[model samples]
Target: MKIIKYLLNSTCLLLIFSINPIRAQVTIGSDIEPRNGTILDIKQNSNTGHNPNAEGGLGLPRVRLVNPNTLTIDSDTEKSKYIGVTVYNTGNAGVPEGLYFWDGNTWRLSVSVSSYGNDGQFLKSDGKGSFDWSTFVMPDYKYHRPTQISVLKSANVKPESYSYQRLTDGGTGSFGGATPSAAFEYLYSDELNILSETANEKYLFIGIAATTRTKTINNNVPRTSYWQIVGIDIDLTDKNGLNVRTLQKNQRLYKTAGGSDLRSYVDLFTIVPITGVGKGSYTLKIKVYNVENTFSRNTGSEGGNFVTTETRFYDINLVDINFILYEDD
Candidate 1:
């Protein structure tokens, strides 16, 4: 197998890309030494919005912020009003008069500052901004990271249940036309079977990778350094207030200096049990925080807030991972 080794020197982490030339399949169940470095988060907000019904209350439902010093809002449904409001620094830091209400009785919730006696800073939603939904506006968010690697075996093998994709033109194709020297590739996410909520009948697997390159067909290249992953938050109830994990320690492997760099490829696979997740669907989140030397100081910033150049925070590419229910398994 042929190998390409391009050593880089910079705070910016660069992912190595290669395509081997072979037509046989190999399975890798062992852990490879992942690239070494520190992982950090670049904040992001979910456009899909959170569920307010999950947290019950008449007025503002207490919401957390990505940074305790950062500002955020949380609201709920009241008697006849479609809105309510709560404000905090996500750090549990309180802002005087930060929390307000639009009783819908005295005001229409849309009353302009001119119409209603205005307070320079007040929470007022014209029904467009406010809903019976729970929303968390975070300052720091991280997406998932996807990697492409080739496995070698003496013979051919069939892929199990891991997700796989081929390199084709605008039209899609399978693993037939690829040559040993060509960069034929596939993708898979171990978390692809997970979901946003937990349901006894529901199951999912989530696989995240870097964004696809337009010029390099079938080549996995990320434009930015980070992306977003949403799954079972594992540590919290709501999917708000982001939590970041770094795989910067993942091992790096490639074909050595004087070898053939070619092989057949397949999707990733894993074994999991279906039990104890609760009633509805659960969301699992994995995001790329920053791709740098990964060996920088202050890896886990207690500040969690990205304020200085030292705070390696950036967004990577991400896609929602899903798992469906099966009749027989």
Candidate 2:
């Protein structure tokens, strides 16, 4: 009997030693071999076929995660060893239930829903796998009208002749000697208050329509009369009356003839971008000027000593004006 037992033990040892080493790849639930390059592959035991109706699924280990910043699953020193570990968090203390993974430093929730915002608010992402509630603001639009429109009546005045006399003895002749002085008359002015509630980049649109009338008469002597509308000047100022921007349009209207009565209309519209200027009071002023209005008689034979009777009149009339403010992107 001892001899038979020794032979059996030797046979068993030989059998064990002859077996192949353990395989590096493993599969669970299915009979098919583990896929290439996979350490462990798990699949549903679908006896029918590989379809969406597969019955069984993997149930990850479930645990109550108390905190995400600290290692509460195991020994603190072992956190680095289980870096890619994942589990189903049942929640504990103040933590919410979700799927979590240990990312070497802290446990991060794989999926989370925030309960911080009201019904009308929207969810905003932090670009780092976090979300919060925020209120969406709509664009703002405002309209303003001129508070005052001052119209100056027509006036008769004798302006200098548009001519330059050549100096004889190596002297310089006067340039633009007949140009009228810059006497701008304010046609419209308005004040707009930008409150803190309307906070955003904005655009300002100004619309203006004006009419001008001029009359020039020549008593023979073959003379020519000249008149011009030197465009509009738009000035924008802040609460402290400091000029912010100045826009000018030059040489809008020009007419020259011996004797004529003319009526002209002009429309000035512009858009200005408003930025950097915070909440404050602002003012918009529109002014008009005529830099040239003169008369000159023909020289030579027509320059005979003749009585010159001429009357020049000019006027500006404001038709309509509008100021609009709207938000921009």
Model 1: per-residue Cα lDDT over 62-175, one tens digit each: 444433223233222343443343332222323222333434321122222334333444444544323232334567543322221222321222122121122222122322
Off-target runs (Cα >4 Å) in candidate 2 are: 1-183, 196-199, 218-229, 254-260, 291-312
Tens-place lDDT per residue, model 2, 165-281, is 211111222222233232334666677555433445666677777766643333332244344444678887987789877888755465544433455677877876665556677
Give the winner by TM-score: 2
All candidates: CA RMSD in angstroms? Answer: 41.8, 14.7
Candidate 1: where is the Cα deviation over 4 Å? 1-203, 211-274, 289-315, 319-322, 325-329
The global C-alpha lDDT for each of the candidates, from Candidate 1 onward, is 0.26, 0.59
Best by lDDT: 2
